[model samples]
Target: MVRKIAAAAIAALFVPVVQAAGWEKLWTFEHGAGTSVAGQTSEILAFDSLNNELWVAGLKGVDILNAATGSFVQHIDTTAFGELNSVAIRNGVAAFAIAAPIKTDAGSVLTYDTTSRSFQQSYLVGALPDMVTFTADGRIMTANEGEPLARPGFATIEARGSISIIDTTKDSVTTLGFSGYDGTTGLGRIVSPGAKPSIDWEPEYIALSKDGQFAMVTLQEANAVAKIDLMSQQIVSVTSLGLKDHSLPGNELDTTDRDLPGNVSVAGNYRNAPVFGMYMPDTIASYASGGKTYYITANEGDSRNLEDFVNGEFNEEVRVGSSSYVLDPTAFPDAAALKATSNLGRLTVTTSGGDLDGDGDYDQIHVFGGRSFSILDENGNQVFDSGNQLEALLFADPALRALIDDGRSDNKGVEPEGVTVLELGDRTLAFIGFERTRQSVIAIYDVTNPTAATFVDFIVDADSLSPEGLSAYEFGGKYFLAVANEVSGTTSLFSITPVPEPETYAMLLAGLGLIGLAARRRRG
Candidate 1:
């Protein structure tokens, strides 16, 4: 259903007047329907404008859809390869990354001829190729996360993360490893405790520049972004996104969901707290603004702790009573206040950076992932951060706020997991998907002015929960958005149409008035 907000409500929320750019939901397809089966988590999506088809990568296999009607056309069984992780289409060939049947650390890319709808070839790639994208120069790229499995009797082999660059023309694959670079040398690195830049850094997502000259890869676990020179086929630099101060005004976040005993509250009373936040981005996209190329990131944090350091070890709750967690008593005058309000329960003096008095205890604490998206320059310098803009807007509007509660506040608030940018009629729009919310929402932003992006509208659907992949395309003279919802095992389609400007409405009214006046004169 299309959600509408009154002008008064918009003004109260300090948002721009609701535009008429109608985002109408066309249809939704359930998981395991048509070629897809139940329990197959649809993770990634790619649109084939040439054939008017949509390609989806799920647990079972790849499902193809008619882009116009959202109907299933075919399902490509990937039983030979393993589970399907990601999909991409270019030059009329659909490509998918399939994990190996027995090996968890190895995968292959299966390419199919869209016209013939038959398998063409399969190329071997690294373990857990999570994301796939095509460059302007016919090069298919995949970000191999190389995350080790966390199960008993699992292989103890350390999986080194790398980027697989496939030359579609030559049908050759080149693996570029990030192990060579250490903070001591060429590029500055963001070093977290127990995280070896070479071993622990996992490449999550890849975003190519418009010209395809450079590729920005998000090292999600490292809280850093790596710049890759496509021509040189090497990582040029890895810049760390420093911690965000949660004590600031726009950076305030609700620290807890268990406010009063047993009941879980949906509404988060956000407050400015003393802590540092890591910007561990999950999904990233690049766009050009002010004649320069920039990248946008959805800071959805993730970490793996199977072997070494346990997860949540640095949390304030775990370290508060420990003698090792020394605090600068002067910095935190009221130690009890810090303990009560801290989101992580306890503050760690060992891992986090700040040491005011140089005496053992930490003056500040750090946490994972900025709960919003950010715009960064080519060198990985942050240009503009959404900060609490997303959270504030969601909290202010009753309709949208009700969709997500404070349950996720202590974690990744509204978890902006997926992002994509599309240019529509001189406007550059950014679509962001929230993963943790009850009712999934694709928040639309007018990102043409990257510095001053305005929240335009939201595409809400109860069935579209946990949107894992999103792509926007213009086909048959209309713009369409496709979302892969993992939780409900479905795919949803929506059409976006620009709302007419106020001047257009005024001109129409004036022309009608003049026509009425002319008719009366003629009758008299």
Candidate 2:
């Protein structure tokens, strides 16, 4: 049966955002599906230019919908291909990345005809092909995560991470593997204990340059980015994304939420600490500025299997004040006091890092994720970091603060997990999604000035939860932002118009021939 938004809901569209930027909610489409991963029904979204529709990829299959109306069209079930991870559409073709029955085995990429909603062809790729995209010149690029897994009795099985490039004209595939960088060192690239760079590195996401000459691949576990020369089809460079110094004045973070005096679970005890944060970004987007390319990262942190703690295996996360945790007395003068719950003691740090010396004790404390968004140069140098901005913003707003999940306070706060860059008229803005928040809070920033990026406002929706994917596009003479809320299982559409300057607003008014002021539409 065709599921479409009711006429009443469609008529009540274009409601203006009350608190922040004047973005209006169009309609939210609920995808009633379940997956093995946290019951999430949506993970990624793709736009079909030829059909003018939205194809939302979930673990079960793909759900097609009318982009402008958020009305359901049809769902193409590809369950035989295994769990679908990502999808991309271009030139009327939709490509999906699917893992094999055994995730460790090789995966496949299947292409479908959007017009007919029929299967076109399939190509074999590397293990756990998680992300798929199409280049401007009609080529498919995939980031095969090749995650590491442990079997019964601690038997480790690993699949080497790689990038697969599909050339349709040539009917061939060229894989860019990390074998050469197996023992690679330096540049803040981390090799997990008892693992090589090839097996330890997992490619999480991919972004392309404006000119389509290069590609940026995010290695989340390695805390680095790999540059691929598309023209050469080779791995050009791997740059390490250095850690963020929380000891800096602007980089303050709240470590233990339930430990401080006068602290509610939603409260923050923001202070400087002897800790460094790894900018292990999840989703990345690239844009051009000043004839150079820059990448935007949503630094939502992750550890190696939180379930390992229950499985009696080596867990990567350890509390600073845990019984097994040992700090170098000399490196930290006030070791006993630092272990207190009000201090860094209750905070979780990665056990795989921070042992600067060969000694048993840790000389430094390293934590997962920057807990904020960041901008990096083409060479993977940090140009801007939203230091303590997200933590400060949520705490300052009572309405937003009331929706916080206290369970996440001991870890990453307002985890910025998804990001997309868009050119809305004269401004190049970045929309970042917080995956940890109960409410879908997409913070906007004016990144027109890359070096000195500033916050504009936030787009918050109470009906949404755990926004995992964000995509922006212009349709029917209007700009829109679509968010895929994983937890709520709803994909929401919002109409966004850039606030105009004084002269620009006057010019727009004169051009439209409006004699009296027109109030913007306000509805939910």
Candidate 3:
């Protein structure tokens, strides 16, 4: 049975007046001077357990902070390395991915010795290494998002994305290319005709298996997940996360925020459209349950229309005629409703997935990410998806609903972006970050039972806006959660204590009763 925490209880505990929940806000620290160039700020976070410090990937360089108290310790300037994208720490060594300074499709990783507090080495990696993680066997893995920089007159100069594996013992780098996984014959290819599995697949984030034997990377644009065998250093499979049927009862999504004139609603115009919703996950995490390995993904969708959107090649208003699969009158009772009520704005389907039915019109319409998170089995089959559940929880409370305007419903509602899982005593908790929500929030859920995740609490701080990174650690017998707020240039810290189980409560009650009986006997 799934246990539900009452919304009233959560709201009451969240208020400044009370501290009823097990989560406590520790401190929030803004970066020095709290100013940086746009698009450059606190991008990622990692904790160095050996040094008892937290490393943050910031605009100018990496910032080191005291893990116990959110105080600044030191700043490691990395300007010479180029813009820093992510940071990872393991075995007293820290590594960060830096974009290339030149026009080449290549990036580099800088390693630092935490104990010595000095730069150790630098290694060239693939283009735009977006995220980095260390395996249990001391191998550094980086997800290189091989996104090409637009050059004039060059239609396709982009290099294919890849995963770079570094052996710390030998200081050697091995890159696994995605061009081979082009969805031709392997599980990487989607059945959807529109899926251009070859060139468009960009590896966004990666999650290592619990035992560290395998790594699963998310292809955000391709709506797929790739499993890599850490030992053999080969991509075993790439499985497409098929679409979610929004017309289904539990999968309804608010397709439009435009309600009738007089009503300024938070729920927006809810729709049960008969269309497939893409599960374009941004950040993914893995856990083991029931002797099975499961992965959780924060389905934050993305699209590529840099050239086409500017060239007027496609517009939301430019209807693909009545033959377009999106114009199913059965889904939208009124024929004109598609144009009038759709919150999809101006977006076009990619030309990759072939046109099914051969009617000279696109047979399917693909939208952005699922706007939620999902738990998938080791095979990439979804065990449970929080379809519109996050939106429903936020909207149910007027105060939380008002935190972010309803306009976001049109484009990636709430936008679940980052996720981190930690073991709290007997329970395993998953913390999900909302990136686009005006006031970002960390939604905590008890994922002990992956299929039946139950909402427990939400951590909201003034500085939590556009949370791009999350790191959790245990120090001095206490667990701590760190949030890297990109927009605010701040790192928010919180302490978490797991809720006691029913058995614990019962034992406490029985002990109290026994004490009372002993006191009565002594009196007699």
Identify the leading candidate in terms of TM-score.
2
Off-target runs (Cα >4 Å) in candidate 1 are 1-20, 33-35, 102-104, 151-155, 183-195, 261-266, 307-330, 341-361, 502-524
Weakest 10 consecutive residues, lDDT, candidate 1?
515-524
Reference-based lDDT, each prediction:
0.71, 0.77, 0.70
lDDT of 3 by residue, 351-460 (tens): 43324555444445556778788998887889888776666656545456666556666667778999998887667778899887778687777677777676655666
Q: Which candidate should be chosen as best, given lDDT against the real structure?
A: 2
Ranking by lDDT: 2, 1, 3
TM-score of 1: 0.85
Q: Determine which window of 10 residues in candidate 2 has minimal summed lDDT.
A: 2-11
lDDT of 2 by residue, 303-348 (tens): 7872462365557888998978799989988989989877777788
- Give all TM-scores, in the order shown: 0.85, 0.89, 0.84
Candidate 3 lDDT (Cα, 0 to 1): 0.70
lDDT winner between candidates 2 and 3: 2
